[model samples]
Target chain A: MVGPVFTWIAEHPKVFWTAAQQHLVLSAAALGLALALALPLAVVLLRWRRAAATAIALVNVLRTIPSLALLVVMLPILGTGFQPALVALTLYGLPAILINAYTALSEVDADIVEAATGQGLSRAQIVRRIQVPLALPVIFAGIRTAAVQIVSAATLAAFIGGGGLGELITAGMGTLDIPQLVVGGLAVAALAILTELAFGLAERRLNRTRHA
Target chain B: MNWTLANYDRLFTALAEHVGLVATALAISLAIALPLGVVSARRPWAYAGVMAVTGVLYTIPALALFALLIPFMGLGTAPAVTALVLYSLLILVRNVATGLREIPHEILEAADGMGYGAWRRLVRIELPLALPVIVAGIRITVVTQISVATVAAYISAGGLGDIIFQGITQDFGEKVVAGAVVTAALAVVADESLRVLERRLRAAQSERA
Candidate 1:
């Protein structure tokens, strides 16, 4: 099964590469959109104590919706292909990122925040220079989780006619093409591991830089 | 779009089925994870290998994993349970290992010095001390499993996902929202309950200490 996949990859390098690009694009777009929305949502939710529970509840609801179902739900409003897939994936990613971000920011040492305030650091400066840096590791972990999840969920994009390696797996399933299925599965698995390692390294580097 | 008692009853039944599947899967995962975690903790090399294997398993996408297993297991409860169990292992094992490792070294040394056997130390000392973290991991695993298990509906393992999947096929917003609402409620209930359990376990551990 693996042999045929390698042979096919060798013969059609461009096709495999193109699929990989599409997969990355989908994952990246979803994750990027999620981070952009979730960070501010986290900040605002944290600041407004009364709104925190409601915000968390909304995210919880969004997160629990099955990704495929969410995609389908979006299809009616957004139409199919990448747009609906991206919307669903972003919605899926937001809860984790938001919760982690909120936790990380709120968990910042109150004394340190107070000290910064005492030094006449503006609220924005304190948030940017102290809270954000202090919260980076946890926020990054959330991003890592979101990244892995988005990458994997992007495979389902094919079900909505959004092109990616999912197309291969879905097609292979229909025809019982073991090589295609295995390749698609293995490729996604490998990509996930690579993403984990890359993020893990980046996390370590950031921690080191922070300490230094 | 008119609300009906039949639809309400069907929704409740689906919610019950989904909860049942999640509970069954979590119980099985805990049963396996607790023992394996303890044994692996005692053996460093085995612990590393087990963590690596489970970690790798965790990265496999839920959809792909389910699709891959369909041929061997056929699409139904069996495959769904198997996949959920595999998914739980990474979190459970890692948490168990961390909890075990975090036990003060001096305490273990004292247990050995007092001539406590390996099994006695593990049973009477390490396991109790590690229970809190283990429960925390289980909480996370259970919450995650509840959310993901909805995907099993795709393979004909009936649950709240049935509503969502049906809604998808029929383009019915109400059905989709119904399923989503139930699942979210389930997640919150499971999470809060486990959190309570985790706190109780921690309190007990502290009392024991």
Candidate 2:
């Protein structure tokens, strides 16, 4: 057995760290932009409930486009930089967040709505102050799913000349660098796990504090 | 950007491989997950463990998963299909287990009263009732695999991605568009067809009830 992927690690600590940093940043950007776009879309769709099914179906199909295919599609237009990768990743990241957010808001307790109406709370105020807070947990769960998925998919960015831990994986594939490939794979996997666990803990803490 | 017969054969070949790769992986995932799902349904502890393992596997980047498998399987179809199968497990297993678990308790009690054994009840009653949910999972697995199998080209597994990648390298926008459109179309078709199947299965169960 060959020893020490540690040799590669020890020799290029900065490179490894930088790649990991890039992967996280890419994931965050994709997830944040997805949420920013999706949350409002979700809110607006709540009023226009008649069109929600059609809208969700369209988003779902957009999501079914392969992440790699989407990346290539971007290359011709955005021409192979972080911009294209970000756009593709953000699009790839949208369906889950939007669907969950919409569902969560729609499923808010009718009694709560009735009570708010009884109290003279305006429709906008009730949705903003009451429904939004209650929907947070479900929406956060969607964000958690999108975040973890984006980290893995963001690795495809390197294929199109974007920077990420995928750079390590691609570089390794080019040069037959076994240790490099494994390190990149493990790092990306580890990041996904850590992200999910962190979100899990945060959600629990949020739930506990709110209940208390 | 020209539409030409020169690339039609290549696109069709790629589409065939893409479908085969996706089909093979889904078949294998069903064989593996369906049983595991059944067992897990009976044991909360097992269900949790299955969820954690498959959930983590699903999170691995499709490219990295293929690359990791390539070391042992040495590229081509094996590693690609292996990765896709692993990816399918999270959705399939969870849905199968949930489907089985969510079956009404009264139905189970009735089956028991009629002297049904475990396997008999499962084969006759449980499975039919579970088909709608199970099919929903299959639809997800199929559509996701269609997207995933396109990336299989990077591993030399060969799919519609060939056109997309070739188009990227050769600067043929038409070919790229062709590949992407076909890929998206495959996913949509599979999703809708399976959804129809899901509804039918659900209808039969409702009619029986």
Position A120, candidate 2: lDDT: 100
The CAPRI quality class of candidate 2 comes to medium
Each candidate structure's TM-score, on Cα atoms with residue i matched to residue i, is 0.84, 0.94
Candidate 2 residue lDDT tens string, B32-103: 999999999989999999998998898777877876776678779888889899999999999998999899
DockQ of each: 0.36, 0.63
Clash pairs of candidate 2?
none
**Candidate 1: which stretches are off by over 4 Å?**
A7-19, A43-79, B1-17, B70-74, B102-121, B124-126, B171-173, B204-209
A-chain TM-score, model 1: 0.93
Q: Over the stretch B1-209, how does candidate 1's per-residue lDDT look in tens digits? A: 45434498888888888888888998999889888887787689989899889988898887778767765787789999898899999899888988998999999999999999998998898888888999899888987788668888877788888887787668676677667667767777888798899999888778877
Candidate of highest TM-score = 2
Model 2 C-alpha lDDT per residue in residues A1-212, reported as the tens digit of each score? 12446788888899999988888788888988998999999999999977998999888778777777777775666787788889889988898899889999999999999999999999899889999899989988888888877887888888777789989888988898888887777777778778888988988988888799
Each model's interface RMSD (Å)?
A: 2.8, 1.6
Poorest 10 consecutive residues by lDDT, candidate 2 chain B: B1-10
